[model samples]
Target: MAKVQVTSADKTKINTYTFFLVSRMDAGKKYYVVSELEHLTLEADSSKVSRDGQFVGKLVPESGYELPQNITIEYGSDVQKVSGNLYSSVTGEINLKASWHMLIRAKGVKASDFFVADHVKYQITSSENVAVVGTDVEDNATWTVTDCIIPATVSKDGKNYQVTELGEEAFIGCKKLKSITLPAGLTTIGERCFAGCVSTLTEMHCLNPVPAAFPQLFFHDTMEELNNSSPVYDCVLYVPAGSKAQYAQAEGWKNFGGILEDGEIIEPVVGETTDSTMTITCNAFEQATGYIVKVYEDAAKTRLKDEYQFDADGKLRSSSFSFTIKGLSAGQTYYIETMAVREGYYPTPIIISQNTIEAKTTGTATANEGVTADKPIVCVQDGEVVVRSSGEISVRIYDLSGQSIVAGKVTGYGSFQLTKGMYIVVAGDESYKVVIR
Candidate 1:
């Protein structure tokens, strides 16, 4: 057996004021010193949080070129050693050194402190990045965060940090979150950050006009409608001025149906028009609200001609309503406005200008001269004629001209291929005008 000798250096005895052995891990016998370092520990929620600083061995004063001997600690069968003096500091002290400390936080340690706003938890990192950590269950609702701590950074218990990203599942299962105003400086949103928040989340106000890089499933399992490309149903993404086009082209960001700029609410779209009727579609914030569609004869939209309201009981969030205004003059320009009404609040109204098609009556023609007026109902589906009445019925399809092209009999449901054009379909005494495209 060989005996071992141990020697230690104390900087305090030399009146060096304060000595710090910056610790670093190395594989060889060479030791290094560092000034400052950071370490993260995995939390129970699977998030990473920084740990408090630790103390390293004391630093020894520089002697001749002959390097000082290494120090080793022995405990039963385990042995550990730390190195110092990497690159010398300008002050003649070894600021960078090798550390034997495990760096990783041990179990039973409390998590880091975080700020709370509108029931949501946010942790600020040393790099000035914000990370959404968690939220309080009892205070779930549509939260609007106007601004975060001023100066972008805050100090708590002598620790300084800033906000930058979102942790995984930050808003998961927050079903009552009707909307959220994201703070600026957010660069990344972890996977599933908004998962399970689909039920009531209808609006997202992103202060960061530039689209941030989002990971897979960022909106996964949310209430929004999902398509092959993305899951952006019923929600609106509001960005800064002149940023609509940028967001519209970014992946995930483009999926939002309504990507409007701040202060720009999308007006209702006019869909499907006829000589006497026109359909107007509008989006709403929540279900159970009342919707009103008003038509005006003048461009000012002050003179109301007709008013249409959806059955209040039929209102639903994450859906659109199409209202048709009938008894209107053909080939006439009209001004339209849509309003969403709730019990306690009055939402902004949207206005648009529309025109009705010119009115025309079909010329009288006799295809089945004896056919009665009560003919089977007919419709077009997938470029084919579908007879939606019981029993076989005589079917005659004619082009825009009185010329009869196909004369046949279809029972129950039937399909037929016709050129992409307007045609008059006659079943018994009934006639239907359909377009195939």
Candidate 2:
């Protein structure tokens, strides 16, 4: 057992804080005490604690002190004693805990270990600097790489693989990629990055322009048509839903033949009654593979009910698909429009001419004979009037006619400013007194 004392020294005064005494100790015998100290300085004066500040320290018996043994110094915190032997008459260990300015060592992380998942598929990370040179990727195999600049020197050894690039592709003949996930930061796709891959590829998510130097193999003839028409791509390009119109108008990206808006699934327009057969026709000059027709009760709220697929020859003629509308109620009105869906062509399938039709009774035979009075001939908005028949026809201006006027090829809606008035509208071999207001 031993006795120890703790103190605090101010500028000019020494204060004895605490003391403890040990028993059963001889004059020649001695003991060791371990102490830990912490300093506290006051920035402002407090009511209970002195403004002069205090020096905190702890003392513990060191009779069994050993290397790497926990020595309890304060009531809450403890310190470890590392020394091997403690002298009986040795003074207590002193720990100085104070605030001192010192520079800290810099911290860093080691480079990540990277290796290609499959030799057929190269893997590149954001920090990689190597070039990928390998065999042609299998058609279904997926090649994933990210955040690396793949120089033009790299070449794809094989075909029909999926090549995802987070950066620009400066190389040529990487066409084996059947599908690609373009990086948002991508700025350009070098020429032929996807050349000779058209047949194997089903889609391309291009975020930037197809480099001008790239060969036509990168895209089909239909995709190249975007330069003259809209920025429509040749293949099915899936974009963020609801961005069809925006993407359709993007520079060098328009003319996506079939721009499907978000959440919209393009299917063939199936007639309501499975028993009722309908014919779908298109006037597209190019050959198409499928035809999509939309059936709607109201023009504004339209949806796809059915889709008709066809072979290449279907594009040249009126391709007909018949479906019986089994449960459709007779006399219900419906609208129909058709378009062409073909491979290597875009803005697909063409938007077929649309019209309204009515369902008839199952056993009844109905024929569309001719135009009746109720459905009079009318001019379409922004459309010109042309007379195909060459026969004597009577025509008169609604408000400016005294005698009967003759009718021929009349254009511009027949008047500059059509106001609400009674007009005598006549055509070859027929006459109809009409009123325009």
Best prediction by lDDT = 1
lDDT of 1 at 400: 80
List residue ranges in candidate 1 displaced over 4 A: 1-112, 137-161, 221-230, 266-437
Model 1 scores what on Cα lDDT? 0.48
lDDT of 1 by residue, 44-78 (tens): 11011111122223322332221112233322355
User: What lDDT would each prediction earn against the true structure?
Assistant: 0.48, 0.33
User: Candidate 2 — what's its lDDT?
Assistant: 0.33
- Per-model C-alpha RMSD: 20.7, 27.1
* Candidate 1: worst-modelled 10 consecutive residues by lDDT: 41-50
Writing each residue's lDDT as its tens digit, candidate 2 over 1-437 gives 32333344441222233222223333332222223222211111112121122222322222332111112222224333221122110122323221111111111111221123233323232332222222223332233422123232223332222333321122223444545544333443333344334444545454333312223323433335424543234545545444555766664445434443322222222222222343322233233455554555554635544444445453245433343333333344445554446544443244322233322222233522111112222221122222212122333333346554433343212332344444455553344343332
Shift of residue 427 alpha carbon in model 2, Å = 56
Model 1 error, position 66 (Å) = 46
